[model samples]
Structure formats: structure tokens, C-alpha cells
Target: MNDECDFCRIVAGEKSAHVLYEDERTVAVLDQHPAVTGHSLVVPRSHEEEVLTIDEATTTAVFETLRCVADALETALDPDGFSVFHTSGPLVGTVEHAHVHLVPRFADDDVTLSLSRDRLDPDDAAELTARVRDAL
Candidate 1:
């Protein structure tokens, strides 16, 4: 963990958060600026700027924490469904540390989380797929 990251401070117990869950590998806490009620963030203990760049064990721990927090949100809030997501890159206002948002969604809520449905050219799709597979 690093000193500069706010999440690291929270993980280190130097800062206060509405902590939902914690273990050796990860921590889950309520989002102060929630999109909806019962919105939470699952963060890994180790400091990594990107989730994809983290080791497999830490990645696994993040997913496990996400599942646990989602289940807890279901039992407590009983939302219609969930919108589990996260933001990345400097263009968006994302925190430096890697985290996953587990947002509890209600059918009546106004918030809409969506992606553009632009059509992808077949050749572009195939090339992109090959590039990703080769990188893996």
C-alpha cells in the first residue's frame, strides 16, 4: 500500500470509511457519493493503479469481495438488480486505486448506466479479438 492514495489510507485504518467488509486481501466500503442507496466499492488491500495489472491472486480477491458485498446488499436492500461497474483512465474522475462499484439498482430509479450500441465492423471486431487474444 502507498501513502498517497486515499484508499490506502482507508485500508491502513488512517482514514474513516463506512466499511462493509474486510479480510486479509480486500475491503468493501460504502461509497460516500453513491449513485443510489446501498452503493459500495470493493478495494484490494494492495495498491495497484489498474485492476487488470494486478496479480491474479489480488484480482481473485477483489472478485470474491465483490460477490460478498453484492450478496449483503441483496439481503439488506432487496433491490430489483445490481449495476456492478467501475471507471478507469484519467479522462474520467476515477480514484487512483483500483476498485469495483457494486451498485444496487431499483426499477424506479432515474439513474441509467449504459454503453453505446454502435455497430462494430466485422473486420475491426475480428482484428480487435485477435489482438486481445494474442496479448493474453
Candidate 2:
């Protein structure tokens, strides 16, 4: 874990967080600045800057914890829906440590989390699919 990272500090118990769950591999905590009341973040104990660079075991642990936490949020909050997401890279997100956001959504909330609604042309879609499939 990087000493300079805030999440690393929280993981190390050098700093305090409203942690909801913890095991040998990962930790889940309430987001200090939540998008909704039950917003939480699941983070791996080992420092990983992004999901694409992490090992398979850590990735599994993180998402498994996310699922467990999501279930808990659902039972406790009984929201209309839920949103599980992550932000990677420096361009569009702030936190450097890899984490997943589990947001509980209510029916009447005036909030919308969406990406561009633009539809790609068929040829462009095919080209993108080919690039991704070939890379895999």
C-alpha cells in the first residue's frame, strides 16, 4: 500500500472511516460525501490504483465485497433500485485508489446518473467491437 494514499491510510487504520465491513482481502465503508444516504464504497486492502491493473484474486474480492454490501444496503434501506459503479484513471475521477460505489436509489429522487445517450453507427460499433474482441 502506498503511504501517501488516503485509502491506504484508512486501510491501515492510520485514519478513521465509518467502515461497514472488513475481511483479510477487502473493506467496505460509507462514503464520507455520499451521493445518497446509503452510498458506500468497497475497496481492496491491498493498494491497487485501477481495476485493469489488479490481479484476478483482488478483483474478485473487491466485487464480492461489493455484492455483499449491496445486499446489506438493500435490506436496510429498501430503495427503489441500486447502482454499482467505479471510476478509473485521472481524467474523469479524483480518488487514486481503486474502489466500487454502491449507491441506493430512491424512486422520487431528483438525481440521474447516466452516460451519453448517443447511439453509435453500425459500422462504428462493429469496428469498436472488433478492436475489443481482438484485444481479448
Indicate which candidate wins on lDDT: 1
Window of ten residues with lowest summed lDDT in model 2? 109-118
Per-residue lDDT of candidate 1, residues 12-93 (tens digit): 9999999999999999999989989998999999888888788999999999999988998899999999998877889975
Give stretches of model 1 more than 4 Å off: none
lDDT of each: 0.91, 0.90
The sequence of per-residue lDDT tens digits that candidate 2 reaches over residues 32-113 is 9998898999999998889768899999999999889888988999999998888888886988898998889998876578
* Ten-residue stretch with the least lDDT total in model 1: 85-94
* Each candidate: RMSD: 1.4, 1.1
TM-score of model number 1: 0.92
TM-score of each: 0.92, 0.94
What overall lDDT, based on C-alpha atoms, would model 1 receive against the true structure? 0.91
